[model samples]
Target: VLPAVVDTAGAATSKTQVHAEAPDNTVFNWHLGDKGATEAAFKAARHVTRLDIVNNRLVPNPMEPRAAVGDYDQGEGAFTLYTTSQNPHVARLVLSAFIGIAPENKLRVIAPDVGGGFGSKIFIYAEETVCVWAAKKVGRPVKWTSDRTEAFLSDAHGRDHVTHAELAMDADGKMLAMRVHTTANLGAYLSTFSSSVPTYLYAPLLSGQYDIPAIYCEVDAVYTNTAPVDAYRGAGRPEATFVVERLVEVAARELGKDPAKFRTQNFVRKFPHQTPVIMMYDTGNYGASLKKALETIDYKGFGKRRRDSARNGKLRGIGFSAYIEACGIAPSAAVGSLGAGVGLWESAEVRVNPIGTVEVLTGSHSHGQGHETTFAQLVSDRLGVPLENVSIIHGDTDKVQMGMGTYGSRSGAVGMSAIFKAIDK
Candidate 1:
């Protein structure tokens, strides 16, 4: 459904008449940090630098496009769906509860051998929903697969946003505060975790690798007539990093200071440094990482590389952008308070057979992420089992009780952490 754009500037008055549910063409409005504190800091700053960044949306073309097959057993009032999904449990939640397709127990969802997700396969789509519902009605299996064109046309796009951010700095070039106003284009309808992506996930990381004492961020999640936008790759963190790093780089240039020196001066030195935003970074050696990176690149050798390129009638330049993310999907209570509909916790089951072999069931479904091998390695190293003797299971609702699935790069940090807990238990 194409939405009528009320305004191209993503104004609050913008209207997307595509769906009756979203009357104003707006999905959600969210804010974080102390605005009063941020404004006061800005007033006191010796320098104020502003930058506008637009993270244009793009389609993720997976090697294997989305496909699904739904099977129903009329006699037992049961249904089974073999589909391409990053998280089968999340799909079942929406299908059974939200869509009223079937009871949770009676519905079984399976995702297997997925080629790639890149955050696209995590959400439930109309094709698989209809496939399962029609199977139950006709008492036969129903199947559908998206060709490349359909996949390209229908799958959610990633990171369409317009942001205006300003950094307030002292005479010595120390950052004192930050103010960011971001207008995120959510497209026609909100995708799974779409509201959370630009709001909670995006705003919290505005602090980046710095210790900005005051940070105020506002996100206007607007609706437009286009493909829905959802989480992809680094999700909001990358966008936040882009904003912070770009602003920092610009601030350095405006102050006539070497960018590396400016960044090093602002590196967060302490463990558990809490920014004005909601994130609390537990530990990182930002300065050390910068030092190492600079050393590895050999800052002194840039002149030689540039000279060699100059001889070939080309110009060479070197630049650096330092960024840090507060890792982990983390702390369900934390996410829920920020308006998440569901808890982000993952589930895992470690089943050790009598034959001394191991089977690991994780809530995470892999699409070429090597989850099977990585998760199995954890079991092998922990249980003292051979890697060949360990098997990893995932992406089946009946086989695995519950899982939040992999997105926002959580499969490794959050998913495996769950398996580690199960193994410990």
Candidate 2:
């Protein structure tokens, strides 16, 4: 179902309808999903089955919130910003474009003592941009830090989607057709990975591990009077998994079969399985994993446990979930094909010092992901060097050349993959 974007005045009058108008110079088309003609089709669909409306807006409540200290040197006309960020190089590029500053080389970004991000500190915030511009404009050092409340209201939120899904099954309980209509809340502005989250990340995973033959999804990303909704943890995959797995379980219950058996029966037991939603799973052992889990949990004994619980006047239900996730940020071509504005490739540079020590500079910044230890271990394992002899450097724009930053569980798969390439070179 398409969400209705209304002004404060329009919402007061009509609560459930979208109004479209020409974009003015002050306002850009920042809505999440379809626009123009595509939006018209979403508004016309009838018979929405499973309506999921989520409106829990969580602002970034970092313990230290957000802080930025900037200094511009008049002699070189260069600028440096110390802030809490997962990717300083990306921030510097964004700041240069937004505030009309110097190129990336002239802008140095340092992330020092960042408390926690939880996906909020990954973006180039307006506060950071303004502070850096003010430092250069006023010809003095400028510093700005966000209070707890400010962080709460301004920090990006996650997973605000209203969705309706329907599954059509055949006589043997095989899923024949599936359809989903979603209205994703984009808040006021579109965050960096915001638009692609619902469309590419969310929709592509709708196929799940099941062998559903036909599937269709229509997502209408809406603009709401709230904070921007972006990636959090598993991002769109968790939301998609919730819908697909829950529906599969419900279908199993309706068919009067064990959820695990039903899933095993429908599981795609093949490699390079292609779904209708444009994702080709490289490899998986669905039935093996399910069987192993059942053995681990003593599936046969659940009936006795349930009966004992019933005698004690307790209603207990045991549920099993077997899910498959596609992570590792993916290839650049894959991301670009799916309408991503940025490249998904990571960067790494391995340099051997004159004293026989090794240094690795990576684009993947670590926010408690333990890059120092893990990266060093990789270097030690690969080059036959001791872990202590390798030092991994990151999160500084001046220290690294180019980077796409880290998120989407991509640090190990994409970032380390890049590091491996560097080591090989």
Candidate 3:
């Protein structure tokens, strides 16, 4: 009945019904760095700019919608769920342990030819759980596939955040400190990996290619009467980039400085720069990258282009964005320290057949990322084998013992590294 209460703004108001007993609808409050110190520094800074970024919810429209088929084998006392998932092993684990669908040994999850996930298919949903459980009760195979309309209405959405960010700068336009307060919308219920998305996944990356001595971020995750919100594409990193870049751009404008120049001056120039946040960036060349970008885009000629466009009553403007992301997800110890419950490492098995053909089994799932070709090429290069002789297998829990899945663009960095280690062994 609460049709209008769809966002965190509404959920925070008294008119909205209390979904959970938590005060102010806050699921958790996550902060990084010293907020008090950053605020004190902001007071003494020469220039400070406050920017509010409102990112609306987005439903991922993958080429193929979610589909599931559940079958129970009576004789074997086992269940099989064929669903479109990014990680079948994780799905099997969640369904087995948390959902009580079946014991891990008695249940199998297979995700084959998932059209595209873009992070939406990573989490376990109600339909798949229902299908698997119903199959056992009815003693028959249960099948369900979401149509385009149903997919839009039901699929886990992504990136609904309201952020108030401030950047403090010195007289010379060098960034001194930054502070951010974000209200993240987790939708009606918490999805798998939901809590991490707005917290550890977000605030840690606030230092986005910048070398601010002091930075602080506080995120209040709220529940609203909306579809479950989760990761999409770049996930939390994209949102962080938006906040940082926007603040930097506006700060440059207010201080009457060149955007690119301002970014260059503030770019993390040194290696092994330990940010006040949790992230410790080991290496980057942001200044050189910006120089190359300016050259490639003909940045100096933008005034002429703008003049030409205005003569024809057109508005033309170019903007710059400096962003950084944390890919290659794990080393379980590091991720677990950040509140991740499961092991973050990916697993792979490499087998050289007696016929000289190679079979590589990985926990990483690929919808449109071309893992088959890339992994096959890698094996061919590493082992001196023909491309056709190498085969990559994935997306089946029964076949691959375990996987941490693919999100945060970790497949190439983490998955391939695991494959390389397996090949070495």
Candidate 4:
């Protein structure tokens, strides 16, 4: 008989008998904030709202499928891999240091004009490693390009989670605390940067835009037989937003309160608000933002619209979501303390040629996000040069020297900041 299969995330979460019950199958089990304190607050709350949220797996199919070309320079004892990658530096680091392909100085990875990544191409896969290794053994360059079918089967998938979340509230409808438990499906073997997604990237954002006094979150990540799951569009923040917004909507309905007013009541008004789950929000005007959104949507006329829809034998509903995301993965000290193996910082070098043209070498890669245009505009505006005269160079590990790559919406914020600093120097 074939071995028992646990391919789907739903099957992996079945409690009757764990499909992945082996000790090693448990990838991560960790919690944020004081569980005891949050539970006690929940017990004493005048009102409580609970929600069970399930997000299925998602596959990223970029316009261009992933491909790799590996060339070995036999005489120089060096290897060059031209592949579809978001971060060539990280790819080189993993291949040389961890995969034992070669020393860092000998292995050079180049990513050129990648069509798109959507977080899928950010990983170093077996095909690239194999191609590079085989090039040496065969004494020739090896090239492999992924077709659509191959991509669907092998590309790192994203966002498979089962979550149970609760919000504790006082009699006046003010949020007291929040408690959340999640089971993330990592699928098969761990991929690059997979371990951080459902943990640090998910739980910390559970507080959302609220002012809950206490919050606790627990995450248990497991391995299944499906393709390896990692970050996708919005990564963990979207999942966290769904949970918080759904709970808030339900809570408003149960309290016979307008969802807009209910959300406004709990919005975090103060600056430098420290959440129990390890986030320190510096500042925000949640009430103003909500008011503007409500006015823009004509929220007061929603009842009339719903009644009109009923007359037309149709259903009408509106939803509100207050989302907060931590972007620009930066400040090496912070990421280092949080278990990042590599520094999350970006790097850049600015050079002005004698002909009055500028070359800006950045670690940020552009996979359809137009980093070249935006970075060029920044340099052109600052340096008083025409946009065409400023060239943004990136992707190749040899050219860049080092980089954290582009993801988590960091190209503009973190990457440009590095370029700005270099220009200043």
Candidate 5:
């Protein structure tokens, strides 16, 4: 069970009461209170059958780190930033507010040739702000790139969570209720989306593809001594999937049932099924995908293969993960209601040049997602113009007036959808 840190001593008490300070030298008298309270409630109800705990830590290995460069024209009162960014215009707006910069009319951000962001490039980093501030300071262009180790300590990390998951199933191997209590590590400070990542992004995905009738999840986002944890690749979905899949596997083994068969029986077959969480899933064929995967993997013939491997003194096991994800983010209002500081809407403008050529500017910035080619392909296909004639431009705040940068696989879905609409006009 996950133990939540409820309280701690504020200051120096005594020599005997003094414990070692955290890695960042933040010292306090530590106390562990309200530990396992959720688990206790579950146990008292007799609804909890299986419980599992998983703890994750941070890993910072930097090859190509973050870098940003900004340019401002004192004459035109405009600004531009060329750096690694997931969303440049969003960075411009946020940095403008935080740094007490001039109106957004005087600011522009450009994300150019970012190598690898993972999830690090998604934030409005201090380095980006410093560059813009320094450019005005030095009266020239300013560039700052994160070294390997700076990226480790400064760049936001991901997936530091301690989770307690419980699954209740009936005698005939049907899941009745699933409950998850997670204590998410928010590090020393709250980063851009740190608070929402664990609660809205992670916990809501616990429903997976199961047809369970009742499910409840609560997340306690707490401060700790480490880098802020945010989105990484699949972000919260992967952790949620891992917990559900692992628990399901263990439950199947305990019930002496074939794992695949158990999952097949519990698959959600209807459309627009609503989970106990906030999400209402759209079109999906969970059973069809599971059946197709079983056929491709030859699930019935696995026994023969396992026996053959046993003869060779090697234990063989086959595992399956049937999961569903919520991608493309959501409507701006939908995400804003969940405590998001900014809107999640994307922006794009298609400008037709005098020669009937096209310039497509988007709020989404692409480090390695190939916005130049893919966006051009989309324009060419839609406008019936030559691919070379359609130039996709992004990462400049001046070019695209407003934007919500890319993350949560929202670039293609939200950003591209905006581009398509603009081009159609």
Candidate 6:
């Protein structure tokens, strides 16, 4: 165990380092947008609100934990691995290219009957790597399955941040600018997309649903003695939303206005809205959504409801939380520029049988997102076939075409979108 000799006063420097390569336990440092523009906005604003927020860490506790089995085909001189990975092709790529286990074509990966993976099973883990290596050496199938305790010990964790944010507003309460400084705890190692999440995913989303004119963000990714951090559920978008929306609410409270009204007043009211932080929202009706929510919740009757609850010896209060996230798995070229190791595209192949049945092959390995029913529906609706006539095939790289796999809630967006395009072709 690493000695606990760090100072509590200097929280940034005192922690015991987990990796020798990362001295002082720093993983990455990243920034975005113009600091000058942010400064000017703050200087020109009539009001400024500051808040510090911490989005607590999470362990992705899927029903069935991570598992893998490896075997070698002696006749063909090939290897195969069956694991509960979200992206088997990416797993194949890492095992072949980076891990140096074998060449790409020589490896056949099958991700069979996985129970669930809420963004945690999307990486190449060490146990599976060792199993594959050991199988070739021992000339037998090597299997490894993680129990709940082992999953807690080994699975990539998510969303640990200590962040400070400031929002600037004009005299009329229109938002002018925003700035954020976040220290992200990346745990022990950079698990797959860990280096990119807090920077590319978090910073660009600092604007949230608001129409802030200028925004600047900085993230200091630090390593600690814990499981490596990675994408969990909404990943960085949730953390970014917490900071921006909390600021919006706190600012509304400071200026003596309804939180809903304040948010609606600053809503991005145009198509192709671009935030200073590197995101271009093509189309949205944020004001309309807020209006519908307020009306549905009966915002005007809050006082009466609170009084009634107090009479009954209870306390009641309404909360308004508005947020926006950039989903659709992002753009490949755009993310590539931001230093992503892989592109952000999914793959699919539609095989039409001569007997009028259909078999669809996709890169997405759906443990619990219902790809079998959903992807089948996509083909059924498009090809004019009955749902039963279409069968979805995935998870096996030897059978399915190469793909980026699923995360960021992209199974419907990019994965199914790829299947739709394949149908068109």
TM value for model 5: 0.85
Question: Between 1 and 6, whose TM-score is larger?
Answer: 6
Q: Give the clashing pairs for model 5.
A: 79-108, 81-110
* Candidate 2 accuracy as lDDT: 0.75
Positional deviation of 202 in candidate 2, in angstroms? 0.8
lDDT of 3: 0.88
Q: What TM-score does prediction 1 earn?
A: 0.94
Better lDDT candidate (1, 2): 1
Question: lDDT tens digits, residues 1-425, model 6?
Answer: 64742221233595565666777777777899889999999999999999988788889998888888899888888999988888899999999999998999999888876877888988999999999998989999999989989988889988888888999999999999998999888776679889877988888888888888899888888877667889998889988888987898899999999888888899898879877877778899988888888888888898899999999999998777788777877466457667654768788999999999999999887887888999999899999999999999998888985987888888899899989999999
Where is model 1 more than 4 Å wrong at Cα?
A: 1-3, 6-16, 19-24, 332-342
On lDDT, the stronger of 3 and 5 is: 3
Error of 1 at 104 (Å): 0.5
What ranges in model 4 sit over 4 Å off? 7-21, 332-337
* Model 3: per-residue Cα lDDT over 1-425, one tens digit each: 44545667556664655465766666788888888889888988998899889988899999899999999999989999999999899899999989998899999999997988989999999999999889989999999999999999889999999999999887888788898999999987899988888888888889999999898888888887778899888789889989998898898889888999988988998898888887777788999999999999899998999999999999998888889888878876447668765767899999999999999999999888999999999999999999999999999888888888888788999999999999999
Best by the TM-score measure: 3
The per-residue C-alpha lDDT of model 4 at residue 346 equals 91
Residues 1-425, candidate 4: write the lDDT tens digits. 54443644454444423344455457778888888889899988999998888888899999899999999999999999999999899999999989999999999999998998999989999999999999999999999999999999999999998889899999999999999888888888799988888888888888889999888998888877778999899888898898899999999999899999999999999998887777788789989999999999889898999999999999998988898988888875436657775778899999999999999999999888898899999999999999999998999888889898989999888999999999999
If ranked by TM-score, best first, what sequence of candidates would result?
A: 3, 4, 6, 1, 2, 5
Summarize candidate 1's per-residue lDDT along 1-425 as a digit string, tens digits. Answer: 54467342554565436566766666677899999999999999999999998888889889899999999998889889999998889999999999998889999999997788888888999999999889978878999989999988899888888999999999999999999999998877778778878877788888888988999998888777778888787778889988998999999999999898999999888887877877667788888888888899998787899999999999999878677664568656557667664777888889989999998988888878898789999999999989999998888888889888877678899999998999999
CA deviation > 4 Å runs, candidate 2: 1-56, 340-342
Q: Runs in model 3 with CA error above 4 Å?
A: 1-4, 332-336
Winner on lDDT (2 vs 3): 3
Task: Put down candidate 5 lDDT per residue, 218-328, tens digits, no spaces.
Answer: 666555545766777777888889889988988888788889888988888787787666566767888888888889988889899999999999999988788877788
The root-mean-square deviation over C-alpha atoms between each candidate and the true structure, in angstroms, is 2.2, 5.3, 1.6, 2.1, 5.7, 2.0
